[model samples]
Target: MLRIGVLVSGGGTNLQAIIDAISNGKITNAEIVTVVGSRPGIYALERAKLNNIPSIVISRKAFNSLEEHDTAVCEHMKYCDVDLIVMAGYLSIVGDKLINEFNNKIINIHPSLIPSFCGPGFYGLKVHEAALERGVKITGATVHIVNEVCDGGPILLQKAVEVKPGDTPEVLQKRVMEEAEWEILPKAIDLIANGKI
Candidate 1:
């Protein structure tokens, strides 16, 4: 089975989605071997613990620089024998060291379609806020390989989520997650695990 190492920062709804996919056999060729959280108290840790998956806390404040922090994360992922690093709402910007080590092996599920409400400074509800402010009729999510460039990688999958009227950033964010991110992320993982990506 493929050993997946997930990195998270916040609520970890995306992590839950992947767990569910595995449980339901939507993805059967792999398992979440390890989970890493950037902060201490994030719900992602609880999700990993509940599933009996090994988890680690790599606090950003513990390191002197971003490279130091990513080096630590990279080392841990290596130690875990992670075949694929999945960034499930993981907010930390990975350093070139990790990117170079993983190459196209790392993937991220961004909240919005690439080249639109994505890239640097575009995360969480901020992407939805930009989509709402711009009055875009459609917004969605993207699962792509992680590279040095923010949200700049070969797109693996994408699905459109409609921008409904009177939608708050939070509401749109949830809709996109449920409608697009949740679905395609696991599908992408399955594809990668099956050597279909």
Candidate 2:
């Protein structure tokens, strides 16, 4: 089985999607071995608890340095014996230790189609706000390998969502999550787990 370790920061709606997919057998040959939150008491941790999955918080603020935090995160994943690491809305910027340890084994679901409204300073509702500000009718989500460069990894999957008229950032964010992120993230995980990618 492909053992997965999920990393999250906020509400974990993407984490929920992965959980649902696994439970429904949409993602075969894979199991969520653990869930790591960037901070304590996030809703993502609650979701992990509800699913009875092993979880822990490794808040960067608690560590003296970024390297220390990254090492802690890496150590936990290694302890879990995770075959894959999924960044499902994890907001923290990972350091070289974790990136080098996991390498291409790490994957992330970005809020945008990427190469646009992505990279540094683009996340959460910020991506949608930028899309609206630019008046882009086509905005979407991307599932990509996690690399040292933020969101610069090879794209595994992308699904476009229409940006409707008078759409607020929150509305577009919800639509993108429902139509693209929810669909492609799980599909990408299945592909990786099955060695199809």
Candidate 3:
């Protein structure tokens, strides 16, 4: 089976989606071998433990320099023999070292449609807030190859979630995340695992 690693920084809802996909046989020919987090208290890591998967905590504050931190994450991926690195709510910006090492093997899920409300200073609730403020008729999630720049990689898959009337940022966000992520992220992973990418 193709071994994969996941990096998470928050609640791991995306991680859970992947797990559900795997359990439901949506992603064939692969399994998530390891999971790493920047902090200890995250539910993502806890979920990994419950599944008996190997997990690690690499703190951004532990390293004296950014390069060191990147190196540490890269080393962990290498140690796990990770064939692919999935970024699910992972907050830290990966350095060029790790990006270069993984190349197109690393993938990320962004909350908003790229080339729109993306790049630095945009994540999670921030993306939803910006989408609501801009009055975008449609907004959703994107799964793409990870590169040195934030959300700058080539798009592998995208699904648009329509903006409904009287939608608060929170409500719109929940709807979009549910509609887009469960479909797109698994499809991207399956494509890569099947050598279709």
Q: How does each model score on lDDT?
A: 0.94, 0.94, 0.90
TM-score of 1: 0.99
Error of 2 at 39 (Å): 0.9
Ranking by lDDT: 2, 1, 3
User: What number of backbone clashes does candidate 2 have, counting pairs of residues 3 or more apart or in separate chains?
Assistant: 0
Please list the Cα RMSD from the true structure of every candidate, rounded to 1 decimal place: 0.6, 0.6, 0.9
Across residues 1-197, which tens digit of lDDT does each residue of candidate 1 receive?
88999999998899999999999999979999999999999998999999999999999899999999989999999999999999999988899999999999999999888889888899998899999999999999999999889999999999999999999999999899999999999999999999898
* Model 2 deviation from native, Cα RMSD in Å: 0.6
* Residue 15 of model 2, lDDT score: 96
State the displacement of the C-alpha of residue 21, model 1, in Å, after optimal TM-score superposition.
0.3
Question: Which pairs clash inside model 1?
Answer: none
